[model samples]
Each structure stands twice: as C-alpha cells, then as structure tokens.
Target: MNRNDRAIVALVTLGHAMVHTYELSIPIFVSVWLASPAFSADAATLGVVATVGYGLFGLGALPGGVLADTVGSKRLIVGCLLGMAGSFALLSVASSVWVVAVALCLWGIAASVYHPSGLSLISRGVEARGSAFAYHGMAGNVGIALGPLAATLLLLVLDWRGVALVLTLPAVLGAVLALRFDVDERAAVADGGTETDGGEEAGDSKADAVSSWPEFVAGSKRLFAGGFVVIFAIVVCSGLYYRGVLTFLPEILGDFPSLQPVEFGGRSLEPGRYVYAGMLMVGVVGQYVGGRLTDRVQPSRVLPFAFGLLGLLALAFVPLSSVGLLPVLALCGVLGVALFVVQPLYQAAVAEHTPAGTRGLSYGYTYLGVFGVGALGGTLAGGLLTYADVGVLFVVLAGIGLAGALASFVLGRRA
Candidate 1:
C-alpha cells in the first residue's frame, strides 16, 4: 500500500473497530447488569432496552449518509468519533436503566454515522478499494471479537462504569488521529481521480458544500432507477441473517457442555465468551480472503456461494454441536468465515451497482439495510428465545441466509 492507502486504511479500520467495540460491549453491559443482585430486568425487558439503542444505530444511517455526501465524509467521521466518545463517557456515569438507555441511544446516533462515512471514504479515497474494505472489515471483526472479551475481562477488574469510561479513550484518540491524519474525503477522491466501477465521477470536488434536498431526492430516484434496490434487498437479508445468528451466538455457545469456566492464574475464565471471541477472530482471515477475491473475481459471483454456504453452516451448527465440542468449534470457525466473507463482496457490490457520485448515499442505504434493519435481529432473537428454542432461531437464520443467497444469485446474473 502507498502512503495514502495506508492512511485511509488506518483511519477506517480504527473507526470500524471503535464502532463494533461500542456495539458488542452493550451486551456485556446487559449481561453484567442482569447478573447484579441490585438490579432486576427480565430477558425480554432488557432486550427492549437494548433494541432502542441498536434501532437508533441503524436509524441514523440515512442522515449520516446525507452528511457524508453533502458535508464531507471526514467531517462526519470525526464528529461521529467525538460523539461516540462523549456518549460512552456519559454512559459510564449512568445509574439508572433509563440513563443507560439514553446513553446507548446517543451512542447509537454517534455510531450510526460511521458506516456511511467510512465506506464512502473507502469508495472515494482509496485506490485499492477491495484491499481497503478487507482491512476495514477485518478491523471491525477484531473489534467485534475484542469488544466482548475486553468487557468481560475488564469487568473482572473494574466496574462496568470503568469499562465504559476506558472505552471512551480510544474513540477520543481516534477522532484526534482522524483529524490530524485522515485526508479530506473529497480531496482524496479528486487525487485518486477515477470513476467507480459503476462509472460516475467520484464526487464534485469543486463544490465542498452539502447537497440540496432536491438534488438528494433526485439522486435517490435515479439510484433506484439504476436498480440499486436489488442490492438493498440483498443487504437486508444479509443483515437479518447476520443479526439473528450473532445476537445470541455467545449464549448458544454457553450451552456447549465442554465450554465451561476454566481457571486461569486464579482468575475464572468463562470459555464461552473466549470461544465466541475466538470464533469471530477467524473472520480476519475471511475478510482478507474475501477482500482479495473481490479484487480478482466478480463480487456478485462470490456473493451467492458465500451466502449459500452461510445458510448451510447455520443449519449444520445445531446438529454439529449435538455431536461434540470439536465438531461445534469447527462449525463455529467455518461460520465465522462465512459471516464476514460477504461483507467486502456486497460492499463491492454496492459500489459496483451505484454511481460514484452518490457512493456515500448508496452506502448509507446499504448500511441502513445492514445495521438499521439488522438491529431487529436482536429483538427477533430475543423473541424467539422467549417463545421458541435455539433450533427455531437457527432455522430462521438459515432461511434468511438462503433468501440472501438466492438474491445474490439473481444479482450476479443482473450485474
């Protein structure tokens, strides 16, 4: 990678990690809160509270995308980082469930700004888009893996409040680093001076002003006319599948007989959390492989197979876990691979399907499908867990993945 590529990757990767860090940490907080003798919240009630935060995280994507397009991606990203840091800092002091809820909502709004801005940065700023996306996704997976682990570990030392406070430092540092090092998104686009694979100008560099509502509306109309709706549908299915499976993944892993608490240097370690984090860590490889594959092969071709395999893996996990710990762990590894392998593919797909000028807007809608709509997966999983069993939940997830696979197949032909 060149200097510019390195800068962009570092910026986006750190931002991506922070986003997942905040997201996954919430569940740890919930788990801790529930375990506390001082507080009482049933599983369903807690799910509702958590859902508010996650829902806003998704809901904020559109506006963030608009800001990325109009105001500039760098500004939005910087603001997002600071906002997230401040919100988490506030969360550290939260005493009541309502305060936590409000803090999470604030975090959600802040966290929502990331995807549209970061993805837009990759689409416009980096020349090696596939590699950049791969690195970015890998960083996010790292965050996803570490967030829970860190929270779990930190809880052993500090209170949840301290953990929240500590997490804020990274975002603050990230924001400062971004301000100092991350290039202006529009200027980067101008420097790269290339059209997206879909054949539109990177953006209007001459006009640094935000896009008007009329132009934004017209652009959306044109984007839909250009058939981005298909990509959007595929993303929604992917999001549902992703959220449904992962929201309860650690809980499911805890059910494994072999994954009991193990003592490590006098500290009791819950293997389930480690196992969960370890499995997700495997996605680093997936991101690398998937990112490279998109650069060489048609991302559309990769999508159907990836999503299809994901569905099959989801179906197999229950049966496999019934067999032995080894079998289940193997399944987890493969599932982890499958989980992240499609990110860069579909991210590449979004860029491929949408015009370069509107890449930020396109990513905004795409992530709205992934994160915004995907946030429902937590609620859906909680509902199923309440009324149904894990078997039914995996079945639903598998079905969602199958639908995404089919959509991807059609998308491949269309592309």
Candidate 2:
C-alpha cells in the first residue's frame, strides 16, 4: 500500500469502526429494554421493532448509493458520522420503545450511506484494494468487538442511558478525522482500464451517473442482467445468514447454562456479553485472512468454501453450546472467524465483477441486499426464539447458512 492508500484506509477504517461500534451496541441495549417495565415486549416483538429500524438501515441504501455517486464518498461519510452521533444521543433519552425505534430509524438512515460511500472510495481509489478491504474490515471488527464490551462495562458503573450517551463520542471523533484525511477516489481507476466486465468503458457506465430515475433503473437492470445477478443473490444469502445469526446472538448465548453471569468489581455481569464481544474480536483475524486471500486466490473459488464453513458452524453452534463453557466459548471464537471471513470475499467479488464508474451504486445495492433484506434475519431470530426452542432456531439458521453456501457454490462455479 502506498501513502495514498494508507491515508484512505485510515479514513475508512476510522469510519467503519465507529459505525459497527454503534451498530453492535444496539443489541446490548435491547436486553435492557426487555427487562424494563416501561415497555413490556417479548423477544419477537422487540425483534420486529429492531428490524424496522435495521430494515431502514438497509432500505435507505439505494438512494444513499446514488447520493454517494453524485455528491462523493467523503461528504456522505461526514454526514453519516454526525447523524449516527445524534441518533445515539436520542437513544440515551428514550423513555419508550417508540423513541428507541425512532433513534434506530435515524441511525439506519445515517449509517446506510457508509458502505456504499466508503467502499466506493476504496474500490476506485486504493491501489492495494484487497489489502484495503482487509484493513477496513479489521477496523470495523475492532468497533464490533469493543462496542458490546464497552457498553457492558459501562452498565456496571452507569445506567444503559449513560452507555448510550457515551457511545456517541467516538463518531464525533470520527467526523473530525474524516475532515483531516483526503485521497483520490479515482486513483485506481486511472491505472486500471476503463472497461467493465460487460465491455462498457468506465465513462459509458457513468454517462447516466446523474441522469434521470429511469436511468438508475436501467443501470440496475444492466448490472443484474450480467453475472452480478448471482452476486446479488449471494449477498442476499450472506446478509440473511449474517444478520439472522448476529441479531439475537447475545440472547442466544445466554441460553447456555455454562455461560452464566459473573461477578467482577463487585458487580454482577453477564458473561454472555463478554463471550459475544470476544467472538466479534476474533473477526479481526478473519478479516485480515479473508482480505489477504482475495489478493492471492480467486474470491469466487473461496466463497463457497467460506459459506460452507459458516453453515457447518451454525449447525454445530447449538449442540456445542450445551456441552460446556470451554467448548461453547471456543465455538463462539471459531464462529466469529467463519462469520466475518465471508465479508471481504464477497466485497472483493463485487469489485471484481462490477464496473469502476458505478462502484457507489453497486455497493449501495450490495448493502441493500445485506442490511435491507438481511434485516429480516433479526425478525426471523426473534420469532423463532419467541415461539420455539434454541434447537429450532439453530435448524433455521443452519438452513440459511447452507442456502448461502449453495448460492455461493453456484456463483463460484460460474466464476
């Protein structure tokens, strides 16, 4: 990576970490909500509520993508950081579930623009694209891992409201950092060719960049008409599997008898939260490995294998959780790795399969599949957990993982 690539990575890395930090913190808050007498709601009902906000997080990506292309990645990112900070500040003051939902809604819209904008910048700007994706994901995992831990620790000292208020600080710092870093989004585009896999020049792809709504539709149609359709399906499966598994994971981990609450600093703490945080922390290694592999191996070839591992892990997750603490903790660590390793593979796949000009639009729709449609995973988990046993939920999650594996397999064969 050159100095320019390093700077770009620094910017996106900070932004990505802050986003996930806020994101993963929400579930930690959900447990508090469930216990509160102010809002009496079961797991399924809360799940649906969370999905509404989480869905918007994904749903808003279409316009966010277009906005990324039109306005530029840097500007969208700054807005994202500020919007996220404000949303969490709202979360700190919530007296009812409705307010909680509203905060999440604002967060969804704010955070929605990030992947499209940041990823577009990296794909077009960074020379070491694969490495850039790795570093970007690694930083995100740092936030993912730290957010829950931070929130949980804060809970011992302060109320959940305090934790929420404290969570807003990092993004303010991220926003300041965003203003400091600058890079050429077109750096890689100039060195690489103008042609897409579909044989259109880069300029041709962007001819309609700022055009009418129908052009956006036509562009999407063209994008889907090619092998990107499979890419689309693969990401959907990825989102489903990822979101389903993660949305209720802390709660799920609590079901394990072996992972009971612990006393630390004279405060009773849930070890499950720590376990969840540890799981996410290991994803840093997964991100690094997955990103580096894409630089060397064809991401398409690895995609199926990666998804297959996730499937197998999900199937094993329930059974392993019942055995003992050590085993389940170990499983969580492995599951974390298998879970996050798939991210960079698909991200690289998107970059390789799509054109340079519409990178923002491509990643926009990409996350829409991931967060938007994928937000359903939360509801699925919530419903399953509400009505059925952990075994049933694992069976359903296993099916989603296997489905992702199958879709990835098909995409790999085509590649």
Candidate 3:
C-alpha cells in the first residue's frame, strides 16, 4: 500500500480504538460505581447487567459483519461511533437501575459494530495485515488501559454521570475524524483482482474481492474444518482467560486489605486502579512484540511461548497477592502484557486459513469465540469468586491457559 492509504487505515484504526475504550470504560466504571453508596444496585445485579451487555456485544457481531459487507465498513464504523457517543450521553443521565440497564444495552449494540467493521477494514485496506493488525490491537490496548484510569481519576471529583459526559467527547471527535476519511469499502476490495499467492501481492489482490454472505458462510465452514478448529479452540480459551483476569482483577485487589495501598514517592495511594491501568498499558507493548514475532516465528511456536507466560502469571496471581503490593502490581502488568499476545497470532492464523473474500466473516466467526463464548468469562469468574476462593479462580484460569498452550502445540504440529 502507498503511504496515503496506510495513513488513512491508521486513522480509522485509531478512531475505532477510541470508541472501544469508551465502550469498555462503562463496565469498569459501573463495577466501581455500583460498589459505591450513590448506586442502589447490588454487585450481583450489576454483574447481571454486565453479562447482558457482553452477550449483546457478542451477538451483535454477526449483524455488524453482514452490515459491513452490505452497506460499508466505513459507514458502520462511523454510525457505531455516533451511536456509542449517544449511548454514553444517555448513560450519563441515568438515575435508576432500569435506565442504566437500557443505556448499557444500547452501548452493547453500538460496541458490537466495531470489531467486524474495523478489523475488516484493516484486512482489506492495508498492505501488511499482520503489522497493521498489530498496530490496530495496540490502539485497542491503549484504549483499554486509558479508559479505566481516566474514569478512576474522574471519580475523584466528578460523579459517574460527569465521568460519562467527559468520556463522550472523544467518541464524538472519533466520529468526526471517521467521517473525514473517505474509506470506500467496496472500492477497497475492487482495487485488487483475485489471485491466491501467499505473499503481499496476493494479500492486496484478495482484499479487492468482496464475498457474498453465502460465499462467506461456505468459506467459514471450510475454516472450521481441518486444523482451523484447533486454532479456534485456542482462541476461545485465550479469550476466556483474558476476560476472566481483566473482569476480576480490580475486585480481587479491592478485597485484599494489605495490598490495597502502595507507597509511591513517599505517598501512599490506593493502587488497584493504577495496577489495572498499568496492566493494559503493558498489553500495548505485548501487541507490538507479538506482531513482530508473528512475522518471524510460526504462530504455533510463538503462541505456546506467550500462553505459557500467561499460565505462569495466572498461577502467580494468588501467591503474589500475599507478597505485598509491588509483586502484585508486577504480576498484573506481566499478565496484562502476555494476555493480549494471542490476538495477533490468532488473527494472523485465521487470515492464513481463510479465503480473502470471506476474511470479514472469518473474523466475525472468530469474534463469536472471542466475544460470544468469551463473554462467559465474566459470569464464570464472578461465580468462581463468589462461591470458591479467589485462589480457585486463579487456578481455574491457569488451567485454561495451560489448555490453550497444549492446543497451540497440537495446532503447530498439524500446521
């Protein structure tokens, strides 16, 4: 791709990243705010609400994919951003449980539009899918990291409503920037002719041919055959492990009295929020490292290494919690970094396996695993923490990571 095209794709990716950060921030802030006396909802009720939003996010991917294929990814992306901004604005005014629930549902619907459209744009628009996706994932990691940290800081003076209002500005700005970029989805595919070569030229050519829904379904079925199933399983397991850790880490830290405060520059501060933010910031580094590794090492080789690190980190979470604040913070950062390394690997693997025409749907199906099946992590983590000890939660997550590691090994051998 030329420099201009590359720049446009980068801008689009950044816009999507900003919106994603805003969408994810709601849940994080809600979890914190619900615990406060200002909110009447109980933890269990808020958990239910969060589960519903996540479920909607997962379920929305299919329609979002179809819409991107039909209308245009650019349109869907901009529309979603607008919808997200409006939803957050509405959420800012919510005073009752029902109002917040309705607002959250809208947020979920808007959030759903992002992945299928944004990722599809990268695969279709950029020359280097791996590097582009790595950058894309890095943007997302930045959003994920910044959202909660910003929300936490806002909470020091402003109410949740004020925080939501503040967050809406970025989404509105993102929407405006998205509108400025003339990303023609149809033209993106039509620019390159159809030919199958396992190189950059082929990647560019495949980007030009848009597939119909029927073709997309047929191609996706083929993907599920052969070794794709193994990759899919690994992705699902990784997603579950990721969401499980991220959803519970704050609450887990909040429950522990000793590790709650950290001495920094001769002043003590509640470290839970900072630790959570630090973990996400580290994930951005992981995406860049993982993306480069994907270009050199086979995903089969790279995935096991990443997952092993994650598994080790998961096991360490329990022990580190008792070892004082610094160890816990370090572990959180390491786990956060390692947690997202699998994304580029999995996305690259899917791109390798599927036809170019159906890349969006292929990604959409993968998101079904990531968002749909992975959405279960919140409820599962919540239940595990509610019924069993937090150690049990860590143990279960560690086991899942180990399982993903084994699947990666098997997949590598098969590949």
Candidate 4:
C-alpha cells in the first residue's frame, strides 16, 4: 500500500483504540463506584454487571464482522465510536442497577464493533499485514494501559458520573475524525486483486470476493483441524489465565494494607494501583518486542517461553508479599509483559492461516475464543476469590499458563 493508505490505517486504528479504551474503563471503575453510598449494588452484583458487558462484547463480534464486510469497516467504526460515547453519557445519568446494566450492555455492543472492523481495515489496507497488525495491536495495548490510569486520576476529583462525562469527549472526537477520514474499501481490494487467465465473469468475480455467513462458518470449521486447533486452545488458556488475574488485581491488592496506600510526594496514593498500571504500561514494550521477535523466530518458540516465564513469575507473587514494593512491581511488570506479548503473534497466526476472503470472519472467530469463551476467567476468578486466598488464584492462573505453553509446544511440533 501507499504511504497515504498506511497513515490512514494508523490514524483510524488509534481512534478505534481510544474509543475501546473508554468502554473498557467502565468495568475497571465499576467496582470502585459500586462501593460508594450513591450506588446500592453489592460487589458480586457489580461483578455480574461487568461480566454481562464482556459476554455481550463476545456475542456481538460475528454480527460486527458481517456489518463491516457488507457495509464498510470505516462506517461501522465511526458508528461504534459515537454509539459508545452515547452509552457512556447514559451510564453517567443512570440511577438504578437496571439502568447501569442496560448502559453497560450498550457499551458492550459498541466495543464489539471495533476489532472486526479495525483489523479488517488493517488487513485490507496494508501490504505487510503482520507489521500493520502489530502496530494496531500496540495501539490497543496503549489504550488498555492508559484507560485505568486515566479513570483513577479523574476519580480523584470528580464523582463517578463526572468521570464518565469527562471520558465521553474522546470517543465523540474520535467519531468526528473517523467520519471526516475517507477509507475506500473497494479500492483497497482492487489494488490487491489478481486477474484469472480464464477471464471470469464480473458476477462470478464479485461473488468470489464477498464472503457470507455460511462461508465464514466453513472457514471456522477448517481452523479447528491441524495446528490451528492447538493455537486456538493455547489462546483460550492464555485469555483465561490473563484476564482472571488482571481483572481482580485491585481487589486482591486491597487485602494487603502495606501495599494499599502510603503518603508519597505529599499526597496519598494507592501504591498497588500505580504498580498495576506500571505493569500494564510495560506491556507495550513487551508486545512490540514480542512482535519484532516473532517476525524473526517462530511463534511457537516465543509463545511457550513467554508462558513459561509467566508461570514462574506468577508463583513469585505468592512469596513476594514481604519483599519491598519495588521488587513486587518489577515481578508484576515482567509477568504483565510476558502475558500480553503473545497477542499479536496469535492474531498474525490466525491471519496467516485463513484465506483473504474469509479474514474478517476468521478474526471474529478468533475473538470468540479470546473474548467470548475466554471471558469466563473473570467469573471463575471472582468465585475462587469469594472462598480461597489470592495465592490460590495465582496458582490457578499459573496452571492455565502452563497448559497454554504445552499447547503451543505441541502446535509448534505439528507445524
């Protein structure tokens, strides 16, 4: 692709990332706000509300993919951003649990529209699909890293409603910018098209170019065979382990008085929260470094090693309770990097295995594994925490990481 196309893809991807970050922040702060007197819900009920959003996000991916393929990725992206901003604004004004739940569901649907559309745009727009995907993935990581930090800072002064109102501005601006930018899906495909020596009819060529639901289903079935199944299984495990711990880190840290807060720089700060954000920030480096390495080495080699390190480091969290704050921070940062580094590799692998015509659906199914099926981690972790200690949660996560590593190793051998 030309430089102009690349720049457009980069800008659009960044906007999509920022909008998604805003949607994700709702869940991150839900627990905090729920504890306040203004909200009547208990911790478990709030967790359920957050889980509902995640589940809807997973369920909406296929429809989002179909819409992107049928209408246009750019349109879906712009619509989703605007819709998310509206949902957040609604959430800010909501009074009851029912209203909050409905608002969250809307946000979930909006969040669902992004990945299929944004990734499809990148795949169609760029000649070097792998690198383009890495950049896109990094944009998402940056949003994920910054979203909670931004929410925390906003909450320091504003009420939960005020925080939500402030956050909506970014999504609104992203929607306006997306609408202004022109991305021609037809041109992108035509640029990459190859002529058949048989001189096929225009109708036949058009039919071959567009993918339907049945074709997408068939492609997903094909992915279940051979090495692809192994990769999928590994991704499922990784999602379960990673989300399980990261989602509840705030609650877990709350149990440790020493890690909770101390006077720093003449202001009170929750050291654990900042430490968690720091870990997420380091994930950007991990993702970029892992992407670069995967371009050179096999994903099987890189993924298994990262998972192994993740398992070992996760175990350190148990003993590090007494180690000073910096040591704990370093361990968390390393583990965070190791956990997130494999995402781009997995995405690139899916793109590599699927045909171009079915790429959008392939991504939709991949997210089903990552977001839909893998989203169970949060509920499972929450249940475990209700009874067991944080150490047990760490052990369970480590076990899942080991399972992913084994699957990656097996898939590598088969490949």
Best by lDDT: 2
Instruction: Please give the CA lDDT of all the candidate structures.
Output: 0.80, 0.85, 0.73, 0.70
Kindly provide the TM-score of model 3 when superposed on the true structure, using C-alpha atoms.
0.89
lDDT score for residue 413 of model 1: 83
After superposition, the stretches of candidate 3 with alpha carbons farther than 4 Å from their true spots are 38-42, 184-197, 200-217, 261-269
Model 1: how far residue 358 lies from native, Å:
1.2
Off by over 4 Å in 4: 40-42, 184-213, 263-268
Best candidate according to TM-score: 2
| Best-to-worst ranking by lDDT | 2, 1, 3, 4
- The order by descending TM-score is 2, 1, 3, 4
List model 3 lDDT by residue over 1-415, tens digit each.
Answer: 5664576566756765786587557656756665777677655566666667776776787677656655667788778888888888998998777778788788878878778777767766666667777788888888988888888778667878899999889888888877777653533344464322233333443443345667556656666876778887987898688767776576677666654666666654556766777788888988888777777877887888788888888888888788776787777777877887888888777766655565666667777777767777777777776677789988988898898999999988988
Record all residue pairs in model 2 with backbone atoms less than 3 Å apart, i.e. clashing. Answer: none
Error of 2 at 15 (Å): 0.7
Q: Higher-TM-score candidate among 1 and 4?
A: 1
What TM value does model 1 have? Answer: 0.93
Tell me the lDDT of candidate 3. 0.73
User: How many Å off is the CA of 196 in candidate 4?
Assistant: 16
